[model samples]
Target: MTTISDGVTVVDHPLVRHKLTLMREKDRSTKSFRQLLNEIGMLLCYEVTRDLPMEMTEIETPLTKSMQPIIAGKKMVFAPILRAGVGFLDGMLELVPAARVAHIGLYRDPNTLQAVEYYFKAPSDIAERMVVVMDPMLATANSAVAAIDRLKERGAKDLRFVCLLAAPEGIERFRGAHPDVRIWTAAIDEKLNEHGYIVPGLGDAGDRMFGTR
Candidate 1:
């Protein structure tokens, strides 16, 4: 229950914790893993959109017409960081069906451990909307930082970062790089291993989720 000064929100819901435990287990099947990720993604989506602007508007109910509060103002854009980020898409879309999607492809260089961008595509009106960048693992923060940089270069003004697992080092570096960006994560683990993987993390999310490794 540590509150970070860096606008990092650690969602402490019991459902998130329970599913994370299942995901962390090495024996979990690929099918179960993906299913759990979607469930957890839905929960995280709920928490992250809490501050969405709402305006009162007239609406019709089953038996009566009345003014109801509805989401208003800037639209939402979900920028998922390639393959791994895809796992969270269905759940997030279930919450905000009208939100646009942006895809950013980045891969870590094994030798230098740097993030290299492969592809980037986003909505034309990115600057006018709220962008939420999704990546399941925030281990090195290099990809997250680079991805946000690309988005800003393309005129994305409002941005938030969401991930399933994050490390203290990665979170610190990410916050320092973009203090304006809010971070929402399910769990912040101990630290990264020598291989740059979060300790006690769910492992390479893309590999496990896609059975690539």
Candidate 2:
């Protein structure tokens, strides 16, 4: 992992770079895009959970008993911002099937480029669990910040944000809003365009993933 800043990590694994490149192709089919995303999500998940706390427990083998390490403490919560964020959920869940899910629904206002939330659901004990917020793109960061705001209001304290791509402006905005939270992403792109879309980014992640465009 490449550290872009104090709390930002870029998952620069070869497989992650290769799959992200494939997904960036404009001609790539929705099926291929979704598949690549899922694969990359799994890779990113592995990197993100690398430093999770572990505890030793005794397990019985055929020949003898052995002490094995397992994730300790409360199961983490995977909080995904709606639609595009959902694309990362399946692959992440495949790795951490025991993790809980919290869904935050928000959309960007086209003209103002602000996040507007319509739904939010989470476990009652969210504050006690680590919350990893997943969103495929972090361009303006309005959605990410808004989602985290709602999460904090609901008592979630330990939080992390994950994305497929991010813009410098978005990173600054996100870090400025929530300095305590760490960020994990496949790559940090150039910048956001006039309409708040990441330059050189695989355009409209939600549209691309769902074939809605």
Leading candidate by lDDT? 2
The model with the greatest TM-score is: 2
**Over 4 Å off, model 2:** none
Q: Score residue 56 of candidate 1 by CA lDDT.
A: 100
> What TM-score, over all chains together, does every model reach?
0.97, 0.99
Q: 1-213 in candidate 2: lDDT tens per residue?
A: 899799899999999999999999999999999999888889999988989999999999999999999999998899999989989999999999999999999999998999999999999999999999999999999999999999999999999999999999999999999999999999999999999999899999999999999
What clash count goes with each model? Answer: 0, 0
Model 2 gets an lDDT of 0.94
lDDT of 1 by residue, 1-213 (tens): 344655999987999999999999998999999999999899999988998889999988999999999999867999999889989999999999999999999999988889999999999999999999999999999999999999999999999999999999999899899999999999999999999999989889999999988
